[model samples]
Target: MTDDVLLVHGGTPISGEIRVRGAKNLVPKAMVAALLGSAPSRLRNVPDIRDVRVVRGLLQLHGVTVHSGEEPGELVMDPSRVERANVTDIDAHAGSSRIPILLCGPLLHRLGHAFIPGLGGCDIGGRPVDFHFDVLRKFGATIDKREDGQYLTAPQRLRGCKIQLPYPSVGSTEQVLLTAVLAEGVTELSNAAVEPEIEDLICVLQKMGAIISVDTDRTIRVTGVDRLNGYTHRALPDRLEAASWASAALATGGSVYVRGASQREMMTFLNTFRKVGGEFEVDEDGIRFWHPGGPLKAIALETDVHPGFQTDWQQPLVVALTQASGLSIVHETVYESRLGFTSALNQMGGHIQLYRECLGGTPCRFGQRNFLHSAVVSGPTKLEAADLVIPDLRGGFSYLIAALAAQGTSRVHGIDLINRGYENFEEKLVSLGARVERPSAS
Candidate 1:
C-alpha cells in the first residue's frame, strides 16, 4: 500500500451488486497456461488481481506448487516441480509484470532455459517484448539479449512456426499460444488474437493436451503435442471488469449489477452499451448496467481486435463519453498510448479533443502513426473534481469513472494503480455505493 491515497467523495451514483472475478485477462493467461502442464493445474474463477499477484509470484519462482483450492476462486497449479529460477529470483520480478514475458514459452517448455526478467506493463502499449522474443525465436528459442533480462534457450526441441502477426496481438497472440502448445511441428498463426481472453487461453490449452484450431479468417493452428496434462479450468468472466462496471453504470447515473457478467463476453460491450444511452439487462447470472434517464448517445467508436470494440472497452467507455449527447468519435485502434487517458478527461471538465488523425473511425494502424490515435468527445460535460494521477490499468478505471462522475472532492492519486486490474477495488468501491476513503496521513 505504498502511500495509497483515494479520498473520492464526488457525485456518487454507483448502484450495487458487484461480483466479477477471474479474467484480469483470463487469470494471468490461465496462470501461464499452468506452465504447459504435466500434472497439476485446477484454476477456477481466480482473481485477487495485481496481475494475480504477479502471476502468483512468477509461479512460485518457477517451481510452481501454488496451492489453495477447496473452492473460493480455487487455483491449484503444481507444474510438477518445473524448476530453474533465481536470476536473483528472476530479477526480483523485474518491473513487476508484463507477466514475465508470458513465462517465456512455459519456461522454455518447462525449463531447458528461461530467465526473462525486466518487463513490467500498462503504459498501455508499445508492448514490445519484441513480439515475445519474436515468438520465441520462431519456436526454436535460444535468445540471449542480456543487460538483465532475456536469456532463453531451448537449444533444440521447440519446432513449430509459420507466424504472420504484424498486428492482431492479444499479447502476441498469447505468445503464440504459449509457444505453439509445446512446439515441434505445426503452428500457423496469421493475424491471431482471437480474444475471448484468447479464446479462454484456447480453453486452457485444450484442457492441457493441446491441439488447437480456430480460424474464421484470423487463423491459428497449434498441433505440436508430445505431452501435457493437468487442467480443471473454470475462468472466463471479467469482460474487462464487465465493461468497467458497465462504464461505471453509464458514468454514474447508476444501476450496475455485473455479478460475474458475461452476456457472451459482453456482446461487444453490450452493443456499445446500447449505443451509449446505456441500459442493459441480460441475466443468466448477470449484467444489469443502467442510466436510462436520457441524453447519452454519441458513439462513432472503433478499437478493434477480438470481436472488436475493446481497447479495454475504450477506457471505461471514455468515461461514458463525457456524459454523452453529441460528438463522441474515439478510433484508437488499440493502444498507441491509448488516447493518453484523455488528458485526465480534459482535466475533468471533459471536452476531450486529442487527435493525430484517424478521427471518425477506420484508417487505423494508428493512422499516420503520429499517435494521439483520435478521440473528439464533446458532450454534456459537467465533471469537476480534480487531483487524479492513477494512469494506467484502463487508465485507472477511467480515473474511477471520472471520480465517480465528479462534482467535488477527488484526490484520487495513484489509487494503487487500481489494484492492477480491479479486484477488491476498495471493496468493489464500497460495494458500488462508492464514497471511498483512505486519506489519513495528513
Candidate 2:
C-alpha cells in the first residue's frame, strides 16, 4: 500500500459540520488578478488547496511577494517587483495545472513577452486553449506555438476589441476579463459566462479601479485604464464543495451542516435537491442538508452554465441518485467525457448505463459526437464496496461518498488528487465520523 491509498469501512453516515472557505475556482483567479495591480492586495477567505499553492508558487516565481495576512485564510500580495524578476524553470509547472496559460496577459502587460508551458488539467474532454488564444489575439497579442510551450508577445500596448465567444465558457470568459482590464480602449464581450465566481472576479477588478459592466443579456464591457491600484476583498464560499457535501449527506442517509455556504449561489441546486426528496435549511452562517427519511425521488438533470445545473455538482449527486426509487437521467452538456467516471460506479454495483445520445435534455455539443455524455441510472440497488481509483477532483469526492454509502470495506487510490480542489478533506471526513485510514499506516 502507498501513502495515496485509503481504506474505507462503509455503511456509515457522514454527520457533523464542515466549513468551506473560498471557492477553488475563484480564489486562484483572484490571485492572478492581483498581478494587474501596482500595490499590495489583500484577499480573504482563501482556501488552503493544492491549486492555491500552485498559483502562489507561480506568483512568487513572477516576483510577486505573497505573505499571510493577520487572519487565517488571508493572503497579501505585492506585485511591485514583477517587472524586475527573471522567470526560470517555468516548464516545471507544465503538466501540473492549466493556470499558467492565464498568466499571459498580465506578463505581457508588465514585460512585453510571456512564455506559457504545456498545460494539463482533468482528462474530461478536449478543453482546448483555442478560446484563450483567440481572445488574446483579438486584444493584439501574437502567439507562437513551440514544441515545449507557447510564446506570446505584445509589440505595443494591448488594445481591446469586440469578442463573441462560440460558447459561454468560464475559462475563456475569465481570460478575456483578465486581459481586457488593462488593455487600451473598450472591450465588449457577448455571450459571456456570468457565474457567481466570475461576478466576484469582476467585483475584484472593480475594486482595483477597473471599469467593467455586465448587462442582462450575457454581455460584459470593460474599459481599459492606464493604471490600477490594489484591492481588499473577501472571496465567496465554495458552492461546488458545499453541494458535494450535501450529496454526501443524502447518499449516506445522514445530516451535515456546511458552514460558510451561501444560499444565493446555490438556489438552483437547492431546488433540485428538494425535488429529489432531500431536505435543507438555510441560515445566515451556512446551510444544513439531510436525506429527510424517505425514498429519494428520481429526476432528470441537465448540466449547463450559470442559472443551470452546474457540471461540477453532477458527479457527487449521481452517487446519491443511485439510491433513488427509479431511473435518473443525466445529460452532461458541459464536458463531453464527464460521464466516463460512471464506469467505476457500475463496478461498485451501481446500475448506471451510458449512452451516446442526449436523453433528458436538448442536444448539446456532445450529442451525435460519439461521446458517452448521457447517463441512465437505475437505482435502489444495494451498493457493495469495491477497489476504486480516483479519476478527477469531483469524481474523487464522489468515490469517497460512494465508499461511505456502501456495505463493505473498500480501497480508494489516488486520493491526493482530491486535494487539488478540496481543502483538508480527509480531516473533514474524520470529523464527520467516517471510518477512513491510511492503509500503509493502519
Candidate 3:
C-alpha cells in the first residue's frame, strides 16, 4: 500500500473557502539553512505535511532543536546544538521525496560528512543527482555511492566555484544554495531553475545574512559567507497545491477560494485557467477559480521549469482538459515519461491517447527516445470511479480531483501520498465540502 490511495464518493460543487499553508518547496531548505545561522530561526506558516515531518526528523537526527513556533504552521529550528549527524534514520526517508539529497551540502559543511538516502518525487522522469554531485565536487566534496545510500565527505575547507547545470532542476539548484552559503568563496550558478520557490528560499537566506543575487535569465550568484544567523521567516504558500484545488473546481464544476495563494507566482496557470473558461479573482488573501459554464476548451499545454506552465500542474489540469470540447494537446517537456501515467486515466473511461513522437508541435524528450511526450484528451469525457493507485505527488492530486468529480464513489488507496507536498489537505477538503473519508485497504 505504499502507493495506494482511497477517495470516497462523488460530491456536488464544492463551495466556501480553503486556505493554503507554507510552501513545500521552501520549508525544508529553510530548515537546513538554519544550521548556517548562529541564532534560532523561526519559520512561520509551516505546513504539517509528511515532508516537513521527515525534514524535522532529519534535523533532530543531526542534533538540532526543533519544535512548534508561535503561529499555527510555525516551526523553529535551533542549530546551535547541531554538531554531528547520525544518518541511520535517513533510510526511512529514502523513496519518500527528492529532498534528502539537498541535505548533502549542509551536512558536509557542518560535520564534514553526509549520508543521503534515495529520492522519490513524481515518477515522471529520471531525476538524477549527477548535477548535484557535480556542484558538490565544485566545492571539493568526495562522493561515493554505497549499496544502501550515498556517502559524502569533504577534506579541505569548503570552497565555492562556478558550476553549470544541464537542466534547471529545482532540487539541484537548492543543493547549490545549501553548500554555497557557508563556503569559502564566491559561487556562480548557471542554468539554474528560477521557480518562485527558489526566490523564496533565497529570501530566507538573505534574511539570515547570506549575500546572494539573481541576475538576468536563470543564473544565480552567491558570494560565500563565513557565518549565517538564524532568521524568522514565513514561507510562501504552496502554489502548486493551490493550482491543484483550482483544477478540482474546474473538474467538479464547482468553485474554490484558495486563501493565501499567490497570483504573481502562478500567472501562467491562472491565464490558462481563464483560457479554459475558468474564472478567478485576485484578492489580498488568496485566489478563487471556478468553471463558468459548459464544457471547457482544448488547449495546448507545455510543462516548463518556471515562469511557464508548471509541470506539477500538468496532471491535475488534464482532468479539466478531459472536459474540453476538442482534443487537448499536452507537451511534457520537463519530465520524459510523464505520459506513462495517462494510460491509467484512459482506463477510467477517458478518451486519452499517448504519443511518443512530439504531438504538441515541439521537440521534446520523447522525440528521440521511446518516452511518450504528448497526450490527446477527447472532450467532455465522463470519469467513472475505479481502484486508483497513487503513482507520485502531482498524479495523486489529479486522481483525487478526478474521483471527486466522478459520479460515483472511488476507493483510492495511498491517501498518504498527499502528505509529500500539501498541508492540511484533508481539512481543506472538509472545508470545501468534499465527502471524503479514510478506510482500510480492501
Candidate 4:
C-alpha cells in the first residue's frame, strides 16, 4: 500500500473556511444499520472515506443494491436483493477497523448466519469483543470459532434480555442496538455508551420505525420489532474531525472557520478551548476557531464520554497543549497506551511527562503500574519537522498539524490510516493552503 505523505514548510497561517461534512462516526454505523431495514435505505450527507467504502463493499457483497449520484456522497441501499457475500474478503479487513464486528446482528437477522473477518481500532489497549459476544449470545445467537473466521448463527428467534456492559464501550453499545432491535422482546441495556454516534444511530433507527428510548442516565431501552422498513435520513456532522481542526487553530496561532461545525455537540471541548485561551464563535453556518495571538494557557484536560471531552479528540488536542505556555495536565481515562504517542512528541522537542495517577478526573482503566496514562505538557517550544509515522487516526491528524506548524519539511508514513476516518484529508489540506504531497511508495 502507498502510505507515504510529505508536508512542506509552514510559517504561513491557514486562512480560509472549511466546510465540514457528515460525521464519519455516524455514516458507517448508519450504513450497517441500514441492513436491518431489509429494504431500500437512503443516507444523506455521507462523507467519502475508506471505512465507509469498505462497509459499502461488504453490504454489496451480501446482495444489497447500493447507489449514489456521481458527486454527492449520499448513499442508497436496497437490501431486498442481497446477493452472495464473500465473507473471506470481509474478514481480511477485520484487522483494519472495529466496526466490522458490529455487523453480526444485521447479517444474522437477514441471512440466518454471520461470518466476521476480524476487527481493529486504536491500539490504546485491549478492546475486547467479549461484551459484544455476550450480548449476541443473550439474544439467542450461537457463536462459533472456525479456522478461517468467526461465525454467528441464530438457530432460534432472538429474545430480548437485559445486557449490562462492563465498560460503556462504544462498539459494545452499538452491538447491543444491532442485536436487540430485532430480538423477540424489549431489551434494556444499562451502562450504555452515550456517545453522539450512538444517539445518532438510535435517531436513524427511530426513523426506520424501531422502538427506542434514551434516558439521561445512560440507559437505552430498545423494544424488538418483527420488521423494520427502509429509512432516508441525514447523518450528523463529524464532531471528532471538527475538534481536530479546532486544535490546529490553537497550535498554529491561526484562525479558521470550520464550516458546518456545531458547538452544541462539543460543549465540553468548547469550554476547555476557552480555558486554554482559545477563542471561538458559533454562527448559523459553522464554528470559527482562533487563538488570541498570545500565549495559550495550559489547563487540566481529561478524556471522557459525550458531554465530556472525547477520548478520540485527545491526541490532536495534545498537540495544541504542547503549544500552550504552562504545564497542561491530561488524564486519559479511556485508553492507557494512548499516551505512548507522547514519547514521539517528546522526540520532537515537546516537554511532556506521563503518569499513572489520574491528574484531572475520576479514576479509569489505568490507575496504576507503569501505564503512563496521563500527561503533563510544558511548551511554547519551537517545533521542527522530522520523519514520522502515522500511529492511529487522531494521532495522524496531530502529526500533520504539527508538520504544517513546524519549520522544516516532514515525511509521514502510513498516511493511508487517516483515510479510514478523515474524508479527503489531503484535499482539505490543500484547500487550507497547505503544501502537502503524497508520494507513491517506491
User: Model 4, stretches more than 4 Å misplaced?
Assistant: 1-3, 69-71, 439-442
> In model 3, which regions exceed 4 Å deviation?
1-7, 361-363, 440-442
lDDT of 4 by residue, 269-382 (tens): 889889989999999989999878878888888887676788888898888888888788899888778888777677777889988777875758778666788889998777
Q: How do the predictions measure up, each by TM-score? A: 0.35, 0.98, 0.96, 0.96
- Name the top TM-score candidate: 2
TM-score of 3: 0.96
Steric clash pairs (candidate 4): 23-238, 62-83, 63-82, 63-83, 91-117, 94-118, 94-119
lDDT of 3 by residue, 103-152 (tens): 88877877898888777766768887777888898899998999888888
lDDT score, candidate 2, position 435: 97
Backbone clashes in candidate 1 total 0
> Which of the numbered candidates is closest to the native, going by highest lDDT?
2
Cα lDDT listed for each candidate: 0.83, 0.92, 0.83, 0.83
**Which prediction has more favorable lDDT, 1 or 2?**
2
Which ranges of candidate 1 are over 4 A from the true structure?
1-16, 24-30, 33-68, 81-104, 107-130, 133-135, 138-153, 156-239, 251-254, 257-294, 297-310, 315-323, 335-357, 360-364, 368-442
Which has the better TM-score: candidate 1, or candidate 2? 2
